[model samples]
Target: MQSHNQARANAARRRQAETGESYAAALAAIRQDRLNEADHATEAGNPPVDRGPDYFHDKPVPEVLTELVRYHSHRIAKHLYFAMDEGRWRSDFAEWQAMTLYKLTDAAAHLNLLIGTITAYLRDEGVGRYFLRRYLQVNQDHQVEAYLTPRVEEHLAGLTGQPAPEHSIIWHSVGSDIASQSGWNHPEQHEALEAALHALYGNYPDDDEAFNHLPPALRERVLALIPLMKDQEHSGAAD
Candidate 1:
């Protein structure tokens, strides 16, 4: 009976091996496909910067969120750039532009998942739930700034409403926390940024400074999201 069971198990194993996909192989294939697509996009004038696992991690809430937005924005940009570069986009006129804008907006909305992750971490910290909720509102402001900042000035202006005391202080601390950290490494950083900018603007910025220095259109996008940054500030000040 034991021999029969062993034979049956061996047969099952052989069958599984013949039909099943290896998880590692599948992952490797996916990565290879992505890399190929990225290379093709770059050749077509869109650079690809794959955001690796290391780029996202445990860090101060504000800082991590801010970086995530930056990183996420670049990914969206690269994705779009490749889409257009590969001739996947059908049109480039104003109507098409509007559609592209919507895509970018959608990308921004999708990034809220990352935002939620950071918010949860902050909540776990000494930060209060109320403050985290408000902080989320402020983080939205930052996203508005970094994403739409380059596209709309008036929008950004309106986005930066009078930040409450908590929002102001906490947001900066977060930014400071991220800025102080030893990140921004990895090769894809600049390439992703450039691709994102080139897709939105006619030209890409030379560096993060150049990108941030972009006229109110892009700068205001990030600027628009600042009020939420102040939520923690107000909460702390309230104490």
Candidate 2:
């Protein structure tokens, strides 16, 4: 910014000498030229960038950074509570699918995009250097993140969750995760079983409730698995 101011002042002096204008008038003219340039750049879809200070310009950088971290922490905690709470829970495949259930929401995609954009931006800006050498990853507790749990594999293995052991808690399993979990042995069968679990289970704690929830014809279709599996894991067929 200092270099830019110096360059602008030099231009104003030259303009004043050439146009026989007062120093103040010359400076005003130079400023107007820059405004016009910025307008043109915006029209061209190449908006100009001269990052010096943001709107909270009076605050020191450390103070600004501190406030950002504090408030964003509150924002993130609220987000997690809202997402993970029983009544508002979400994941990869809320919509029905042949594969058990991938997720109940698209939040993972949103979080990944956030991580990609912010990390790239911080590194591009010189500020990212502060932690680069000292930290193994930027996606540490310092930033938002997304990941999968073993439960996803559980779901894929045709392990329907058991009824809530208590009102607030549900123990999820079908058979031994190792026994039921298998490689893609029978593609068509696996696909059938995977889909059937989510569709049949359908948030019902009991198998009968899930079966009753669906029309008889479609009820069994939900369990179709690709990399196939079944809890108690038998459909009178070979794996």
Candidate 3:
């Protein structure tokens, strides 16, 4: 009986690993597409709104990064807890696939347009270097970042001719693998997530200098987000 039980446990573990892998692959693909869309949107001249630093002008950079890390950590923890619950918490595989697929689609659409505009402005103002630097600094702390941070950093670092340490790369890759196994539903958690992201974007190196580097349309988008970022700051504080 003991041997039989051990075999069953092993089988269950295998299944969980497989499920997590499938989920992670799907998520990574979705994020990639979203990033691409942002670039495409900017190139097409259909720029989205950019909320200026009012979004996060008053906030500190390290605080923003910390918030982002906490938000994701909380999200991942909740999802993992639910996914591992074999009782009332057990979710159907179909549900997991469907939900993540839709989330990816939406996230990609939003990012494509936003990132496109943001990058265009960065290119114009010659602030891509600032962005690259800030991103690198925040991502070097792999102990806390999500799976996406290092991956994005790796690609961005390559663009800047900076080599990412092998250990950091491995750590993020493993984190991503672990994240793929989670599947918790919590839109309520987005408040904190958005706040952190807004803070990071708001605290760009130099507002005037960076703005000058961006294209007109891209500038408009950045300008638009400033308010939103500020709102998020207020919201985060209130919470």
Candidate 4:
């Protein structure tokens, strides 16, 4: 029996042959139809997990790196909550357990890819060294963080002698402008950027010169977020 996706692929091939359409175009159309069906299913309150590509897979290298760092950081943050309250929850325990298991399994599948992507970016990007340092500082996974931080620090220590705070300062600075230009419309992107910035700023609590190494425009944007960072610090202290 032909599976649904197989049937769709066959139909797409037929359409491609009949209309002289590119295979890529046919596949894109099929994907769009599948997405539309998924959207309809969601609207009917029976939301389906699409489980397509990871959010960053198709993005440019810089954006991919940004999202990779943000995603893992968010995962680590959630793990902290899960760790602290593993058995205390009563309501939604089943659902939470299912989702947590799924995320853990899924993340494990992608761990190697995530590491490879970051390594590739660090090797290829023009400001790779700076970004590598920032990633090391901001990432909360202690095992990988401990391993990579010293290696990166040692490699660049001779030239710069310290971590370059400007990478994150510039990344978040540009990210804010990008988010604002979209009128802060993309809640998911905004949330991801906020998480990334929180992680970045959280690592440099007392560094008054954190943004000083950034370009003027980027520095201005980063400096503007000091109040928010301070607020986070206060909230953390209260907790």
Work out how many backbone clashes candidate 2 has. 29
TM-score (C-alpha) between model 2 and the true structure:
0.23
Cα lDDT of candidate 3 equals 0.43
TM-score of 4: 0.31
The candidate that achieves the highest TM-score relative to the unseen native structure: 4
Global lDDT of model 2 = 0.40
User: Which tens-of-lDDT digit does each residue in 16-76 have in candidate 2?
Assistant: 8999998767777887999898667556763224322222234444432222223223334
Residue range 1-239, candidate 1, lDDT tens digits: 24322343344455457768553343334446666975675567532243222223334335444554565455565656654653455655756666667666666654553454454444334454344445455544444234322122221121222223332433333333334432432334744464444444331221223234455664655434334445766889999
The total number of steric clashes, by the backbone 3 Å criterion, in model 3 comes to 24
Give the clashing residue pairs of candidate 4, or none.
none
Which prediction has more favorable TM-score, 1 or 2?
1
lDDT of 4 by residue, 1-239 (tens): 56454566677788789889886677567768888976775567632243222323344544434545455454555554464454455467877687666656655533533454454435433433444445445444443444443323332322222343443333233223332433222446536455446435432333333344455755665556766767998999999
Deviating ranges (above 4 Å) for candidate 1:
1-67, 82-110, 138-186, 190-239
Task: Please give the ranking of all candidate structures by lDDT, highest first, separated by commas.
Answer: 4, 1, 3, 2
Off by over 4 Å in 4: 1-90, 118-205, 213-218, 232-239
Off by over 4 Å in 2: 46-239
Instruction: Select the stronger candidate by TM-score from 1 and 4.
Output: 4
Candidate lDDT values, in order: 0.44, 0.40, 0.43, 0.49
- Per-prediction TM-score to the true structure, in the order listed: 0.28, 0.23, 0.21, 0.31
Error of 1 at 160 (Å): 31
